[model samples]
Target: MNIDEDTSAWLGCPTPLEMYKHQCAMLEDELTTAYQLLKKARANIAGLVQMNDLLATEKAAAESQLRSVSADLSRVHVQGSEMSKQIMSLKIIASQNEHLHIENQRLLLELSVLRGPRS
Candidate 1:
């Protein structure tokens, strides 16, 4: 139909051109908001990535420390075992010394008896 006829038919409604412009403005605002949100999301993602990298580095450091501690513990265990073995040897020697002391004391008593009563 004619433009005037279409305009007349719209009767109190906004004209098509005005409606289109308003819709375009609304769409532009929505696009701007979406772009801002996207930018914020990218920033958040970058921060998370950096945090993850830091955590990974910390984990590696902790693991290295754990390995070092494990090595130290292993050395301590070996030293403790050696100490235990030395203690056992010492105990055996002490027992032998006690027996030798008792035998020597008995021999001295026998020698005194063999000499008869003192003058």
Candidate 2:
């Protein structure tokens, strides 16, 4: 209430109202800094999500291509087996024909011997 009392109060310590105002200003600055950090963190999370989606798409495409290549290899194996079986069948037929020709030649020689000195 007196000038001397006011001067003594200011010199010794701050009033309660003045301390409260200072604390409020400090808290406002801290809140602004926290908000800026949170915004940057959210942007980083969004970029990571997009990168994960792209990797998943590439993985699916690679799996599909692998399956297609496996199917083609299986088809080639089946065709090769069929060709081997045909080749074996042809070999058996050729052996049987050679035996028949040899038998025919022996029979013709016997017939000429039985006829004796033919004119």
Candidate that scores best on lDDT: 1
lDDT of all predictions: 0.95, 0.89
Compared with the true structure, what per-residue lDDT tens digits does model 2 show for residues 3-87?
A: 5554646567878898999999999999999999999999999999999999999999999999999999999999999998998
Q: Write the per-residue lDDT of candidate 1 for residues 11-114, one digit (tens) a residue.
A: 68877898999999999999999999999999999999999999999999999999999999999999999999999999999999999999999999999999
What TM-score should be assigned to candidate 1? 0.66
**TM-score of model 2 vs. true structure:** 0.52
Cα RMSD, model 1: 4.9
* The 10-residue segment with the lowest total lDDT in model 2: 1-10
lDDT over C-alpha atoms for residue 66 of model 2:
90
Q: What number of clashing residue pairs does each candidate have, in the order they appear? A: 0, 0
CA error at residue 41 for candidate 2, angstroms: 1.1
